[model samples]
Target: MQADIYKENGFFLDEWQLLEDEQALPTEPGRFLVSLERFVAAPEAFASLPEIAILVRAGDDVTVLAPHLDRFTMVAIEFAAFSDGRGYSSARLLRQRLCYHGELRAVGDVLLDQIPLMRRCGFDAFKVVHEPTRRALETGHLAEVPLYLQPAARPDEQPAGARAWARSPAGLAR
Candidate 1:
């Protein structure tokens, strides 16, 4: 695999402007994406790309696209800067309220510190801009733990899956 970035929450800087020129897009037409400007400035563009992916900024006019999300394959949210956490909330809404199952990627300012929280809010992949050193990335790996956890061990969070599992015999054995 050529390392597709739908796995990270960062922007693929090399591919940022790939769609600026309409003709540059793949003629086969499988996935399409729109920048925040295009979606906000011209809603018609959404209709033009039938099954495309889109990129949106947190502050952009996202409400306009709410009704048209089903037409998209994925909606990649741009962080622009790491300090901006608005994208996280947007991702949460897309998954929880909108019921968006398509790919959701986090691009731009993808810092190492944000992956865990990003996944919680519904981001599946990232185009991590600041690729961490081998040691730093490896440190976060918990071999003893399962691939996933419920409730996140946060004070106010709860996991329905974990709760249900705890009621089962298998859960009781653990």
Candidate 2:
């Protein structure tokens, strides 16, 4: 429960608890986050629980979740490592192709430098354990260039009467 993001997102502390694989479901009957494997193992059990979130790992085909998208109230994509970029694609697919409207969260190894890009990829919340990243988020001192050159899930536009280097992702799409 360490995501420091927009105050309105209500991620200051994780309201949903992440339930790892093989872990027993809590008896308190609260919102829980479970991996896709656990959900698939016994979909019925998870379905009975209200407000369950699904965690999608890297390299997993997001399309597989299309059928069950409605069952999930939230989707957490694991980064595992900062160098791995597969999570970005997962977020995009969930948002663009699958038309998932649930809460999208970035978890595991989340870094400050990647927050903006993650946001563009449709991640609105983050579970960052990195100290530096947490500090940066708390201080609202993100070192972002604010000039993306590639098209992303979240559209961006070029500023009128601005330098070419300032071109946004929307401009490149055309």
Cα-based lDDT for every prediction = 0.64, 0.79
Q: List TM-score per model, in order.
A: 0.63, 0.80
Candidate 2 residue 123 Cα shift, in angstroms, is 0.6
Candidate 2 Cα outliers beyond 4 Å, as residue runs: 1-11, 156-174
Q: What is the lDDT of residue 17 in candidate 2?
A: 77
- Model 1, 1-174: lDDT tens digits are 223363533223323323652444445545556675665566664565556677878686555667777776778889988789899878877877677888788878876667777777777777644646223444554122234455442334556546776788998999
Per-residue lDDT tens digits of candidate 2, residues 10-128? 43767777787878877777889888877776888875687898988988777878888998888989998889999999999999999999889898888878888888788888877
Taking every candidate in turn, the Cα RMSD to the unseen true structure, in Å, is: 7.8, 4.9
Model 2 score (lDDT): 0.79
Prediction 2 TM-score vs. true: 0.80
CA shift of 172, model 1, Å: 31
Q: What is the lDDT of residue 119 in candidate 1?
A: 74
Q: Runs in model 1 with CA error above 4 Å?
A: 1-17, 21-30, 46-50, 133-174
If candidate 1 were superposed on the true structure by all CA atoms, what would the RMSD be?
7.8
